[model samples]
Target: MIKCNNVQEQAQDLCGEIFERWRELLQSGEFILGDQVLAFESWMSDRCGGAHAVALNSGTDALFLALRALDIGPGDEVITCANTFVATVGAIVAVGARPILADVGDDELLSVETIAPLVTDRTKAVIPVYLRGRPLDIDPIIDLCRSRGVAVIEDCAQAIGTMIDGRQVGTRADASAFSMHPLKTLGGLGDGGMLVTRDPGIAEYARIARNHGLENRNESIRFGINSRLDSLQAAALNIKAQYLDQWLKRRVEIAAFYDDVLSTTRTGTDLGRGKPGNAYYHYVVQSTHRDELQAYLAENDVQAAIHYPVPIHWQKAWLSSQPRIALPTTERLSRQMITLPCHHHLSDGDVEKVVTLIKQFERAVRW
Candidate 1:
């Protein structure tokens, strides 16, 4: 099957390096959080343009802790894209803040224009996501938030290698959250995440907050949670981080191939093309017949999935409390986006086969 992701195959290919790291970690006997975790954090910091890094248990925690570090809580409003993973809004609600959903532009990304009008006195922060690893010009967003005194926490969960004007995306915001979930370009064997910030105070707060808010072994500084990155996961992540650049390069090549071939299809709309900075976490296409197309691909052994079928605001958990807000573009696109296979594991032939299958589906729909 042409799966949306090939984590097992990718891990199998790196079994030697993974086993070696695992062996060293097991022998060290310092497994919880140690040199390995610290090393990974340092590496991430450097990758994010020298930002102070605090490794966490999951991407969700990274987002939650970023809010904690910023003192954003109850009664405060946090603005984020409506069409995002639940974790984005979950982080805000987790921190006792109200989540304000903003509509995305045609590129399916948040912009200063969509966000500026949402800012108010209660606005504590704005979380702009690099959805599908497509980087937007964030300088304007940063400038807008700065002038308004609202913190900007970039949700870089799907965008580790994503760049803008030669600098990585995580470094541009006040604090950014990243996930090392196995499907990510720089994923570890298991779940892990990192929070990057340019501020030392926020860095110190996150460091303590992740470890039960203890400044020392005996003294507690604040009420915090246990969200430390595991040494085993860190060890594997350290090994995987080495080949990230090449993996990203391969993903872009596959996305470019998809763009070139799929662009001609009349029923489907190809997005994120011709952008050098896009990490192509998921090569997405919008079609009026998205469900039918996905089913057709599945029949042909070509796996395609939806990144998110329901916008966060429309979720049952939030539907009761969230006022009926109009996010036309977000609501409209939720039913149309389909995530195709675009990973480093696929070869040229694999990509061509998938493209051929999609073309076949498109042609059949035309009739």
Candidate 2:
């Protein structure tokens, strides 16, 4: 069976190094905000073009902290894509701000064109999510936000190590949030996240806020949440970080194969192929027969999935709170896109099988 990702195999491969680090942490007794976490943060900073990286418990918290550090709260409005993971919009709500959903381009990512019309006097920040690890040409978005005095907090949960013009995506924003959930490109053993920024003030505020606003053991400067990254997970992440580029390269290779073959199909079409620096977090294709194709893959022991079956604006949880808006591209893409397994673990034969099965399904549906 060709699965989305062979996480266990990757974990097992790194167990020896992870266990060694775990044993060291166990003996040292310095758990929270310890050496392991610092080491990982240092690596992240260097990789993300010298940004100050603040390690946190989760990516959602990373976004929330970025908003908090920027003093974006009640009465402020945050603009983000409607097609992104719920975390992107949820972070705005978590910080007591109103989330404004923006439509996406053909690349399934937010652009200045889609977002410019929605900006208003209350706009506090713009979180352009690098969905599916496809890096946005963010300079224009940054320019747009900068001219209006709005902050750019990139939602980089899926796009770690993705570069644009030889620089990483996270470095260009006011602050960027990255997730290390087990499924992410730079995933650790468990949940972990990082906030990257060039601003020392934002970094300092996040560092202070993440530890319950602790200036010291007995001092509390302000009310804050406990969002510290675990030392054990950081230790595991430090080990996994070494192989991230290798894994990403493999994923790109797989994506290229899928793009080459899937482009000719009458029933399915690949999106966002020509974009450079795409990390290919999910190899997505749009097909009118999405449900049928997914079932066919499952029957053949080839696992396929949906990145998102529903857009955020349509989600029942936010229906009443969210303004009724039309996101034509987002709504249509959600129903048509199917995510195929595009991971480092898949062999050449596994990829070929997936493509073959999809083509077979395409042929069968022609009638």
Candidate 3:
């Protein structure tokens, strides 16, 4: 069966170089905040068009640090999209802020129009996630936040290399957090994350926050947490960083192929699909017959999944006893979305096979 992503195959292709670097790092014993970590941070900062980048243990840490740098805590509310991964909301709540979810656009990214209504006097920040590697419209969001004196923290977990109009995603917000989980566009072999900021003070504060609130190695000036990136993971990430552009290109090529085939197959019907603007982390398309198509694909030897089957507010953990406000767009998206394979490692033949299987399923169900 064709899997959604094939990280093992990609790792195998570079194992020799990866292992050589890993062995060297193990022997060095300079683990935390070492040369490997510094080099990776510099490389990532340059790539993301930021003056400073702080490497952390995970993407969730990156978000938490960014919030801490901005001094966001209890009594503050952070506006974010209801359509994003729960981690986005989790980070805000973990930092003692209330996550005020707003509706996302049909494209599955945060919409500035929906955000305005959610902001209140207690709202301290807005996190617009680049969901599925698609860039959200950042300029307006930035402008809106700036006008209101609120911080903008971009959740760029899936959009490591995505660019809008001309600028990169991380460069657009006050600060951006990127996840290097195995499934991300610029994923490392193990977990890793980075925080990018143009503000020097914010960068400095985040650096201290990632460690234990130490103003310096010998000084503990404030409360902080231990969230440093492992040197071994940095070594693996440095090697992977060298090939990120090529991987991004291949993903774009595969997405184009899917678009060509799926569009033709949908001819007169409304599949509710749009041409993706960047890397296809997940080639999600909307349909009323989502369940039928999913089961059909499974029978035809193609593995498919959903980006999110439940909106944040509907999750039992997040629900309250009070009657919930209706979020029509978020509800529709949860039921209609289905993601197909669109990874860098997929061959042209793989793309063709996936498309063929999907078309067969659509026809069999008369969708």
Candidate 4:
């Protein structure tokens, strides 16, 4: 079967380099919060337009830390998109803040217009999730938040290389949290994340906070968590980081091919016509027969999946309060979005084969 992502295949190319880094790490023997971690942090900061990047154990922790660093806690409302991964809202809840929901635009980004209505005196921050590797049009949201004295934390888990007007998405917010999960475009060996911020205060606080809020080895400056990005993961990530641009290029090429084909067939809708430099992490398409299309693709050995099938407020966790908010677009799109294979490992032939199978399905429907 043609799988959605072949991380193993991609990792094969970097095996030697990673091993070398690992060996060097072992020789240096700085395992916990070592030089490698600092190196990776520096690399990411430089790459993401000079933002101060603090490496952490997971993107979830990064989000929690970013919120915590900002002193956003109970009674504070953090606004985010209704159609985002649970982590976006979960992060808000993680920091003991109320999560206010907002609808999305046709591009599936948190509608800047929809968010303004959700803003109130309680709104402390706006966490705009950069879904499917497309940076949200964040300037308007930034303007709105600044006027209201609200912070912005960009959920950039799927948006490492994504650019908006030549600047990376992570650098566009007050703070941005990125997950380097095994499935993300910039996948690490295991769970890893980074928080980027232009604010030096936020950056310093995150750096101190991620290490259990310790100023020195024994001095506990504040309450924090142990969320360090390990030396080994840093080494592996540095190896992968070298080839990220090329990988993103291949992913873009594959997405364009699928977009061109799907446009003609009209079997699916690409709602992620995001900002110009989107990284196309999971080439998503919306369709009425999303479930059917997914099943048909699986049957044909073309692995297709959905980014998310359930809206946040509709999840079982929220069934108690049952948020009585109008999110018609988010509710409708949740059941209609399907993600296709847009990994770097797939070749031109693989892309063509997948498109051929999709077109075949559309043709079959006509008959």
Candidate 5:
């Protein structure tokens, strides 16, 4: 059976370099905020077009730190898509802020139009997630936020290398958080994340905050959390970073084939949001019979999944805390979308098989 990603095979291809770096990292004994982490951060910041990059233990912490840097707490309101991963909403709650939902469009992107009404005087930041690796056409959103003096902290957990208008997406926002949770386009061997910002002050604050507010070896500048990114994982990422572009290219190729075959149906873009640079984190399609289609794929030995089966607004966790938020688009899209395995490890023939299975399921449903 063709797996979603043959991670072991992909890693084995680079184990020689990773183990060599590992041996060096062990010798240095600067495990925490050491040379490996600094090297990865330097290379990463350059790639992200950020003035600084703050590496952390997880993407959840990255978002939380970004929020903390902006001083979003207590009654401050944060606007984000209702269809995004729970981490996006959880981060706001983690920082003691309220998470307001914005509906998404057919593109699975939350736009300025959808978010405009939700903004208010208490709006501290808007975390527009680049869902499914396609960066939102966020110029309008940024312009609106800037007019009101609201911060735009883009949730770029999915789109590390995505570009819009010849520049990287992370560079477009005041700050953006990226995940390397072994599943992202630039995945690490384990959980890892980074926060990038153009502002030196925010960068400095986040950097210090990630290390328990340490000003010096033993001095505490403020109350902070321990969320530093591991050097070992950084070493692994350094090895994998070399092949990110190559792997992304393969993912794009697979996405193109899926797009052509699934075009007649309700499918998300393979290349993503009218750009060749999206990370293609997930190749998703909208199927009214989503549950049936998923089961069919399973029977056929194809592992299809869902980005989210339910919108965050409707989740028991959110609805219980807050009143029902009206988000028809988010709710509908959640039920309709089905994620197919389009990882770099799959061959062209594997992709063809996935498409064929879905087409067969659709035909069976029609009959």
Candidate 6:
């Protein structure tokens, strides 16, 4: 079966070089906060066009640290889209803050307009997620937050290389948290994440916060956690980072192929076009018969999945005594979205086969 992502295959291609560097790191015995970590941080900062980048253990920790660095905690509420990975909301709750769920736009990604209604006196931050490699229209959100003194922490887990009007996602937000998980556009061998910020002070504080909030070797400045990206993971990530642009190009090509092929099929009249700034992380499409389409793809040897089927507000863990606020757009997307295969490993032939299979499935179910 064709997997949604092939991180192991990509890593295997670079494992030799990565292993050699890993050996050097192991021999040096400077494991945590070493030269490799520093180099990766600098590389990521330059790539994201941020003043500073702090490497962390996971994307969840990156979000948590970003929140902590900004002093957003407890009685504060963070405005974020309901239709996102639980990690986005989990980070907010983990940091002792309330997650204010907002609806997504027509493109099925977070937007400033949908977020405006969620903002209030208790709202301290906004995390506009770049879901499925599609860069959310964040400029307006950033501007709105700036005018209201609310911090913006972009959830750029799937949009590592995604650009908005030539500027990267992390460059626009007050801080952005990126996941280098195996499924992301820039996947690492293991769990890894980075926080990017234009403010040196925030970056410095996050750096400290990632390592148990210690100002120095033995001095504890504040409460923090052990969230350092392992040296081995960094080495693997650096190796993969070298070929990220090429991989991203391949994904774009595959997504284009899907668009061309799926457009002609009698699947659904409305396939829902991606926004101009999207990078097609998962190449999602909207179909009224989403469940049926997914089942049909499975029968035809095509693996398809849903980015998120349940909105955050509906989750049992996040439920509160507060009255349920209706989010029509998010609720609608939760039922209509299906993600198709769009990974770097897919060849032109693979794209054609997947698209053809989807078309075949659509034809079988056109009732």
TM per candidate: 0.97, 0.97, 0.95, 0.96, 0.95, 0.95
**Per-residue CA lDDT of candidate 2, range 177-222, in tens?**
9999998878888889999999999999999999989999999998
Worst window of 10 by summed lDDT in candidate 4: 266-275
Give per-model CA RMSD.
1.3, 1.2, 2.1, 1.5, 1.7, 1.9
lDDT of 6 by residue, 74-179 (tens): 9999988888889999999888998888777777777777888778988999998888777767788889998889999988888887888876677777888999
lDDT tens digits, residues 3-25, model 3?
Answer: 88778887898899999998998
Q: Per-residue lDDT for 225-334 in model 4, tens only?
A: 89999889988998889889998999888878877778877665467763478898888887777787789899988898787888888888766644667788887778
Clashes of each: 0, 0, 0, 0, 0, 0
Model 5 lDDT per residue over 110-147, tens place: 88999899999999999999888886788999999999
| lDDT value, residue 222 of candidate 5 | 95
State the C-alpha lDDT per candidate: 0.89, 0.89, 0.82, 0.86, 0.84, 0.81
- Which 10-residue window in model 3 sums to the lowest lDDT? 267-276
Question: What clash count does candidate 5 reach?
Answer: 0
Tens-place lDDT per residue, model 1, 29-49, is 988889999999999988887
Model 2 worst lDDT run, 10 consecutive residues: 265-274
Q: List the residue pairs that clash in candidate 4.
A: none
At residue 146, what lDDT does model 1 achieve? 93
Clash pairs (backbone) in predicted model 5? none
Q: What is the alpha-carbon lDDT of model 5 when measured against the actual structure?
A: 0.84
Q: Quick one: how many clashes does candidate 2 have? A: 0
Model 3, runs deviating above 4 Å = 267-277, 320-323
